[model samples]
Target chain A: MISKASQSFQVASPSVADQARLRLAPVIRIALLLAASVIMLAPIAFAVATSLRLPAESFSLPPRWLPLPPDWSNYKMVFQQVPLKSYIGNSAFVTLSIVIGQLITSALSGYAFGRLQFPGRNVLFWLVLATLMIPLQATIIPVFVLISKLHLADTLASLILPALSTAFGTFLMRQYFMQIPNEFEDAALLDGANQWQIFFNIYLPLAKTGLAVLAILTFNAYWNEFLRPLIFLKSIDKFTLPLGLVNLQGYMGTGSISVVLAGVVISLLPVLAVYLVGQRYLIEGIMMGGLKG
Target chain B: MSVQAREHPASARRPRLFAKLTEPSLAGMARRKAAMGYLFILPTVLGIVIFTAGPVLASFGLSFFEWNVIDSPKWVGLQNYDHFVHDSRALNSFVTTGKFVLLAVTLQIFLSLLLAIGVQATRSKILRYFFRAAFFLPLLTSAASIAIVLAYMFHQDFGVINYYLGKIGIAHIPWLNSSGWALITIVLTYVWQQIGFTFIIFLGGLAGIPADVQDAADLDGATGWRRMWDITIPMLSPTLLFAAVIGVIGALQVFAEPFVMTNGGPGDATRTVVMVMYESAFSFLQIGYGSAIAVVLFVAILVVTAIQFRLSRSWVFYQ
Candidate 1:
């Protein structure tokens, strides 16, 4: 399944030394992979390292690469000095609600487009795809106006309502539903199931994989979302994790880098946990989207 | 394409069921299902109408008027567009944005392609999964969090980057303070967070290539560079096109990294068009002008998408 291109370049000779060199090639490759991993993991690892240090070590000229006697108090300050707990709660509420909302809409619309015979199905789906053509940036200004007009600004509703608008989710579910054999729905209908019954009983049950994919992607996207929340939420109590961390950075006055970094580590915990745990599914979901594209 | 997939064997089966159900209520049953379909689609359609389509139309109308958040909009006509032509800051922001997009997206594709190839060519399951998870770790972290840590890590004095530079007998580089280096720093920050995405996509693309193709190439004595260029690359063209379109579109709209890192500082050197739009509408309260900028950006993106579609007809290889 795997071969090193450069090392395998001259494969004509069948000498013992050539075979030995071939055996040694993966050693060099693995070493290089480790080097790449260090570069890739440096920023986050450094953040974790900085977050663990006492304030005394933060200002070291060389900036201690390793935090000796990892200051556990920094984690405490993450809560005591800032509203990190509430910020996390707000982020979770927003992310979860958005995920639930998207799952419902995407599943329904995806089922409609993928299975149900309706007039203008193709045209309507194309209209949905047209939304992807224009940037969200263009639509945001007016959406902000509309939100403020409805007196929803400075509230989590502003974030959640617009967050629920997703063409990609529908697209993903439609593709998945299309791939499932139609016999499931047909057999259900033949058993006296109505279209709605077949949809709920037959289609939705078999769509666990699609729902999982949409849920994971939706959660990750909303949890990391910044620009919308930054514009929407006004009060300190209402700020999401991303907004709160940036605010914490500014509020720490550059003297408490350790505490600020602690806030970052705290903010990362939930999403990081989700990503690490559901990585296999999330990677597959992402790849599915890519291959279709 | 899905058109063929949508019209598979099950399609031929559908008419038989319809023919068997030739009751007088057949049309009524079909009508009921159609209504049910409408019911299922109402929420998404409503969202599309209210949030996406409505806002877009309103934005165009809003572009004709100058309004602060509190006051009524005053009509400005084409003055905003006229001013856009003369606005050096807006023009320069595009220049900076284009530069960042070119640097960041190009490097992202190159590094991600290399990483994907490397990750795919490794035999160990532990190594493959580890590399995938490690590289993708940053993507799960919020852009703001990444930016703050990166901004500190690139600090002129006590930054870890400079610390490493000194250890390697190199001079200190002004990563965030200088205008020239600031955008590059922002690009690097973005690349760090985003490369994993492209890498995963490319990895999927690479894995999609059949195993026997490699064996066939080996049999033909086209094992290494020759195989990659002549066979692998052509086969991966679809993924390459997909990644390029996504990368360029994403890179074009870069806001958070630059917004948090430089705040478009050192005399507007790192200012992106979206950041400018954001700053104008929110900070400067030039809603009309902001809308005009948004319109320009929309047109630019539309043109780019159209060009990509036209080019993909020729470039994207389908199995």
Candidate 2:
């Protein structure tokens, strides 16, 4: 026991020490993660902090980590300097209409593909899927021309109508609907309900998760949309949130940093609210879509 | 309900009798199905035709002719394609776009994977939710707002980044003004905005992995580094590949940030291919030339995607 074997045993025990390593591993990993999280969150937190600071303090030599006397007036000035309220209103109106339109169109089409029987349904569904491969940039010029010809340019209609139908939304809904048992609809049909009634009553309720996901995605897309609005809407009164923020640049320059920061904060609040409310559904929806891809 | 039964009895009776009359023929049922199906999908079909397919074909046709919105089209016959193929600006745009995509996608996928794994190890539900929300904050904010805030933050003289650099005793770098740094700043911004999405996808992928496999590996003297390398990485390859593909596609279309932040400036270092297409179509009114560039970009995406799929066969182990 007190021979050469004792030396090897001691070294082996140190190498094979599971309890110490296992206990230390997760703690170290979590600490590193927490540090990383702080780095990831710092800039956004700073942005929020700067928005609340006085304009002079925003760019102080040793930048203020937190404001002394928070200049809440920066938000007030943002509203006064730009048509921030109108922009928010327009964004909400357009985003809501687009989401509603997409919901109706996608649900109907998804039901058709998932449940209904027809000639060439597969072909049509595949055709819709094929459209997703084409980038939006390639179609923007023609879309611009089409909007101009319809005399919808410079109107919110241009923003709302074109985005009301998406292949991704339809596909997502179809996949979700297909997962639902047909027995529910069969039961409704046996009770003398018509197809439309069955869809509205049975299918729609069952597809709540899909609908929530679609609504969140549609709202996010419309809210963050920039190029289409930039090209189509000419009037400042009609500009959406993104366009308004872009125009805010002209007024603020580098001098009014606090006001600009306030614009960022103001613009993000609605989206943040939506994300918080629908976080669960959004995570599920994105995961579903990513898996198929 | 009683009023409908009484008033529309004849209409309902007729439909019932008619259905009985047509019950023998499968052709009638098939026709009914076809009609209902067409009715159900009509709106979506019409929307796609007018909005998506029509525009795609129209863009293709427009790519062969020269026309500003104010003037009639003039047939250019491959001239646009020739100009795009030989143009210096077009070449520079391709190079810049390539660099941005390579840098942004690689860094984004790597960081997201790391963050996702870290998130998986955490047991505190509150902290998990908080970190997830923090990561997703950038995605919810409008690109225009983020660009505005980041531009200020990256400002050379009075910006916070430079202020910190001075504190650390490093010389102030022109983050957006210099050509070399402008593209890198844009890339960093793109990565920051996109990492959350990648992280979420990886988290979803991580949750799908079986826990027993890890336990088996642990019992077999495979713990920590060996366990992760032998088990986790191989199992997570599908998610990695998916992220890589989407990340590359998104990176190639890097327009909004560069457009808002640098205007593709400081000698066009941040001028992505899409930015070039935007400028040509809108700024120069060269629709044909712009379309040609877009076509090239589209094909490049196809090739890159195809390459990814091909390479995925080797590394992507679907467990």
Candidate 3:
């Protein structure tokens, strides 16, 4: 077969320089990748190392690469200096609320836009897409005033209320719903299942991966959200982890460097945990943002 | 117009008389489906109208009026815009933002592309996975926390970075202390945290390049840099554009890094447009000016994004 012949036919042998380059390329690539990984992981490793060292040993002439017999006192000091627990709790509540809210709103709208045919559907989807261009920083002024008017200023509700719905989440879920086979819907309809029944029982169950992607992405985003909390929440008691971490760093002049690093470590743990568990979903979802329209 | 409602095979197989009997109920069912569709979208529509679209319009309106939360808004059409023109600090902030966006986005894209190519070239799966995960690790941490950690590490005296450099016989670099290096440090810190997203995107794009095209390039004696530049780069242009667009948009709104690390200090070195907006609206209590700045930023983003698309036509390959 022509195809087999073509597959078997190798490119003409190269000169010595070309052969040398070919043999050296992968080694060079691996070295570069290894070097890049070291650069990426170095900061966090240093942070962890610094957090375990004493204040006196923190900035020694030659930095300690490893903190032997690691001190847990710096982490304890982080707790004493800041309300790390309250910050974690507040962040968890707000992030979970937003995640649940977005799932409901995005899923329902996504199902409708993806499956159900109606007048103005394309126009409505375009409207949603347009909002993606409007940066939150551009709109926060009015949002601030709106929150103030609602007498929700300085409350966690201000943080939670506006973020409960996301244009991006809707788009993501709509794409996900569109990928599901239409045959399932048709089959369910023939089985006499109403629209709500079909959605809840069949399609919703099948959309677990999509929902997980949305939830994880949303959690990572809002948990790390600083601008909204910085602008809205005035009280320290109402502070989220990011705001709290920044506040802790403000005490860098008085407190030990180890304590501040400890605080940083504490704030990142939950996100690290989520990432370790759901990395496949997170990476795929992020890739989807670029690869898909 | 609606999609044609799919007919059941049983209905299609039925006699014309029976089909006629079912046609009225099928119309009723279609109407109910439409109603359900509207109902499903109601919450999302209401939320968007209230939160996103309404705020956009309101911010535009507020740009024409001065309000400082405690007092009534006084209409002053064109006043904020005029002030913005004369405000050197605001203009300077935009310039700083431009510089940051240029340096950070370019490095972010270039580095991530190299990393993606490296990861893709690896023969060992475990090494590939390790590299991918390691690069993306920092993205899991908040910008605030990362900035906190980096601020300490980049300290001029008694910091780890300077300590290491000193060992290499290099003098201590004033990373965050001086205005010259502040923006660069911010760029480095930001790229460290944000490059993961773009790296993953480029990896996805790299995976999509066809094997036959690569083999053809190889047969043409295009190996190493030549192959990457002539074949790989052209094929990956669409993803590069996406990464560049997203990167620019994000870098333009650089806030948390500068806000936490430098507080836009050392004489407005790292002060970004969004930082200016935040200060005017919150710290300085100049709501109208902040809104005006916000409007300018919004327009800047729209224009920049539009320009990227327009320019991309010459370079971006569809396939």
lDDT of each: 0.82, 0.80, 0.84
Q: Which candidate is the best by lDDT?
A: 3
Alpha-carbon interface RMSD for all candidates, in angstroms: 3.5, 7.8, 6.8
Q: Which clashing pairs does model 3 show?
A: none
TM-score of 1: 0.92
User: Can you give the lDDT of residue A146 in candidate 1?
Assistant: 91
TM-score for each of the candidates: 0.92, 0.92, 0.93
Q: How many steric overlaps are in each model, in order?
A: 0, 0, 0
Q: How well is candidate 1 docked (DockQ)?
A: 0.50
- Candidates 1 onward: DockQ, in order: 0.50, 0.39, 0.41
Q: Give the per-residue lDDT of model 3 (tens digit) for B1-319.
A: 1212235655666676444434436676676668778888888888888888999998899999988878899999999999999999999999999999999999888888878877776779899889989989888788887898888888998778898898899999999989999999999999999889898999999999999998898777775556777888999999999999988998899899999889997899999999999999999898998999999999999999999999999999898
- Residue A87 of model 2 has an lDDT of 93
Cα lDDT tens digits, model 2, A1-293, are: 11221111111124546556555666666666667677667667778899898877778777777776787989999899988889999999999999999898989888888888897999999999888777777788888888999999999999888888878888988988999998997687568666667778898889988898998887887888887887789999999988888788856788787887888887788888888799887778767653111
Write down the worst ten-residue block by lDDT for model 2 chain B.
B17-26
**Residue A195, candidate 1: alpha-carbon lDDT:** 70
Question: After TM-score superposition, what is the CA distance of residue A66 in candidate 3 from its true location, in Å?
Answer: 1.7
Best by DockQ: 1
Q: Where does the lowest 10-residue lDDT sum fall in candidate 3 chain A?
A: A1-10
Q: Give per-model CA RMSD.
A: 6.5, 5.7, 6.4
Query: Per-residue lDDT for A225 in model 3?
Result: 88
